[model samples]
Target: MKLSHLLPALIWLMAGSLCAAPPHSDVRIASPWPAQNTILAMLGYGENIVGTSMVAKKIPLFRQSLPRIDSVPVVSVNSGHELNPEQIISLGTQILFVPSSMTVPQQDLLRQAGVRVLAFDANSLQALTSRVQKTADALGPDAQDKAQRYQHYFDRNVALVKERLKGLPQDQRITLYHSMGNPLTTTGRPSLNQDWMDLAGAKNVAENWFAGKQNRRGEVALEQVVAANPAVIVAMNKRDADAIQTTSQWAQVDAVVHHRVYVNPKGMFWWCRETSEEALQFLWLAKTLYPDRFADVDMRQETRRFYQDFFAITLSDAQISDVLNPPQ
Candidate 1:
């Protein structure tokens, strides 16, 4: 046990320990949506993803490459069975990321299975930023730098929105529809889209009766929209926007006739990747609805800056446009 002899043994042990530490290049993860997958990929952890839910595979980036668990709830599913707890654990995921709508049973199952479940809230722009940082922290040291960068862009983007909306008169604020799905459903007060629209200085008409309701899919008659006469109509997806324009039944609405229709892309899951694409959609909606107030703001350039400063990705104007205006 001479000092020199012990030194070599200690060095050998140290090397083995270093090798034993998990590598950042690969890790098992499960997500409820494709946007989270995209966010992870943007953070340089894309290659690390081992498994994803069916929804995550829809994005072009992961559509072909990832394995589908068929574990996610159908988009039409409003309440229970949204999360397949057994299938999630069967994927052998060390960490599971879920949307904010997780149920009590799902939480119990994850706890029993020893899987770390991180729920992200995309309820508002601020909530989205906090969730992004929390997700980054869960990924350990490899994601530290990327997490800091993500926070930076989030801060910059939100600040600009507040600054732009500060001096707008109440009458100057526009009326918004906050459409979702093929039916062009508007936000019912509790819905995340409604909150975002409010932040952007738009008045959400749907909140009139459905305020604080449990059901987000609350529907109003075409007469309601026609009478409210919103200055602008915000559609969640491109298909929804097109349906409003082409569908005979919807043509009766004032928004369609007035040409106030605005489409927001489904980025990161609009419900969860709250910090990234959802926030971008908010800014885009703000600028689109109130161009005069945000005249100096260039959302495309801002989006590119977000990609560069936060996700470390270089996105061109065409690529950004494609996300904004998906193929019909």
Candidate 2:
């Protein structure tokens, strides 16, 4: 589907007079991360955002105000055909910011087309720091302060999660089933989602069976999932929960019987957007699954604060509840 035509504020952003020393005037950034977009926009580089691949654009700030570009320069399945080199050169993009797993051939193509591509991933504590530094260097000395601030806040979030997870008893820890998509797939042992689950003090049920660096997710038979009987089944969509709830086959699962299913909040961009908001999502999910262990944390207030501080947007209590309480 073409998202470019649905965008409402592209003209307004482009029409605004350019700044004399716009830090990103000469640069064009394409990121799938929501947090990256928030940071770039906050620093007055929103106008410089020529394109976006952010999956969180459905959320309030992005849906209402962000520009949508004609095409994304990357493909998930094949890196070679991710972007057309001729088209990229025509766009006049000086640089492309991508995730670490972006293929070497894609990198070479960008270079050959006179475009610089930098890959980064902030899935772990250490990687987050490196990503900040690299982003700072790319943006020049002017972005140093912002980069440091990003580092400081992200560090605190990670530290807080680590501190909380440290004291949980292994046996008492919740068993999680992270529903990935249409087929109801889940994160396997080696995926980033498993890392987040571990960080949240939960044991991933699919870890032992599937093993791969990329998320080992695929269709999970309903009967099999029920047989495993996880303590918490985190379905990304409320609709999925309803579908499972209605299925006669799921009656055997402990999670279904005990009503222990939860859906992650929308607009928080935990799934697709890579903003610092993600750190907040990790915090929120951990607190949600183990409320007693994290009773002091207020995920709703925290999420609202993140939106206000980073995206310059505010969310209402009702909206927050909608994301937290999803139909079931």
Candidate 3:
């Protein structure tokens, strides 16, 4: 038979098996958030994933681990913000994981379709931890063990970094300018990126200027960055870091002059955001801000171990380098 003709039969068989299993045994999960997918994969629930948002397909680590990911249908509209309820229903998604940014009406639409909606706040470390635990609990009792193990690993790594940097005085911390894809765009106190900087013991220059602003992300003129003259500039990606370094207007900035600009790492997910790899992000940021203090830290080893422990995959040397120094 032609492969096209067999596809419908295959889908029917899979859907039948999914529906035939006990109510909680064959749960089909869909999430618009790549971080939540990463958490599910870490909890050994990758087989339960039936659908995901369009953005999840672009994550290199996710693609590397989940070979069948492309077979899963996307449940969001092209706009990236709106959910496609019809497509979601077609995919037979039982549970939908969404970020807190999702509006009430969107959740209502999914719930009305018999899809249970689980919303998580990924803005802070505590919130991210809670989300992970809650997601594991929803999966089942067996998943709780994996969640606790991950939590233990997270707590231990964070405490280690905290202890190492505890003695440093507040005045001695380095000042950082975090470039959110553009040199002119930066994150302030309201953003989770700011939380990463705080954990790394680096001060965010944008927070001082945008303290009372309602928006977490704000744009400042090139001249403002030159005026702030932060000690270091960290870009979300290599392209952004290169742009900051080459811009003529940034020539006089302290970070540009001193060549203190660096790109944050991109793994299964962007290290700048809340993800299962957050503990590694903290370590990487801390090391970037204070080399001498974290000189003994082996980034390659840490990255390798994180993938092995969390995703149950071992990365090659080239993969490790790619995650740390992604292409521009």
Q: How many residue pairs clash in each candidate?
A: 2, 5, 0
lDDT of 1: 0.63
Worst 10 residues of 2 by lDDT: 6-15
Cα lDDT tens digits, model 3, 78-149, are 444666655565666777888877643445545544567888876778888899899988888767888898
Query: All candidates' TM-scores?
Result: 0.78, 0.77, 0.88
**Model 1: colliding residue pairs:** 34-56, 35-268
* Alpha-carbon local distance difference test for all models: 0.63, 0.61, 0.80
lDDT of 2 by residue, 1-328 (tens): 3434422233233223232334455666655455566556644455555545545454554554454423333322244525444444444455666666654344554554445677786555356557656776777665666667666776787788788778678898888787866426776765566767877888888877665434466666766777678878877777887776677877667777888777766663443224544566667777877777688888788767766765566777876676566543
Backbone clash total for model 3 is 0
lDDT: worst 10-residue window of model 1: 69-78
Model 3: residue 226 alpha-carbon error in angstroms? 1.3
User: lDDT by residue for model 1 over 140-186, one digit each (tens)?
Assistant: 67676777766666566678889988988988788877666555455
Worst 10 residues of 3 by lDDT: 2-11
Q: Clashing residue pairs in candidate 2, if any?
A: 33-274, 34-273, 34-274, 35-274, 35-275
Q: Per-prediction RMSD in angstroms?
A: 9.1, 6.7, 4.6
